[model samples]
Target: MTVVFAALAVSRHLQDATGVSIQNLVRTLRTVRSATIRLGRHEITLALDIPAAAQAILDRLPPRGH
Candidate 1:
């Protein structure tokens, strides 16, 4: 739940900071499949099936940074 909301907030913040939009952020999300919202664990798991673009984004981001 928090991760979902945080994603939303981060999307908005990044959009504002980069002069992008929610659509662009969603487009990025679309680049991933294995990265999912795990209800039981409350974390994102990058399975082997994840898209390359998503993996690139994840790689660019710090593990636990805003």
Candidate 2:
């Protein structure tokens, strides 16, 4: 869950930088594996499975032609 939250934070940053929606970014990604965060000299790593995460995001989106 923390990994997912971290990924969402990255997505939000990307959205702000590129003006692309998170949904669109996920939809277009061919691979999204993991995220790493560093604090001081330590690093935190989280693994993410691409298909599962993408599907989770897709499931939350409203259906097309709304």
Best candidate per lDDT, number? 2
Error of 1 at 28 (Å): 2.5
Q: State, as a TM-score between 0 and 1, how close model 2 is to the true structure.
A: 0.38
Q: Compared with the true structure, what per-residue lDDT tens digits does model 1 show for residues 1-66?
A: 999999988787666655546686568667555555678868776665656655555565445655
- Point out where model 2 deviates above 4 Å: 31-66
Candidate 2 lDDT over 1-66, as tens digits, reads 999999988778667654558777666555766889999999999977667655655555556655
**Least accurate 10 contiguous residues by lDDT in model 2:** 53-62
Q: What is the C-alpha local distance difference test score of candidate 2? A: 0.69
- lDDT, candidate 1, at 53: 59
Residue pairs in steric clash, candidate 2? none
Off by over 4 Å in 1: 1-9, 12-22, 34-48
- The local distance difference test score of model 1 is 0.65
Native-to-model Cα distance after best TM-score fit, residue 54 in candidate 1, in Å: 1.0
TM-score of each: 0.39, 0.38
What lDDT score is found at residue 6 in candidate 2?
97
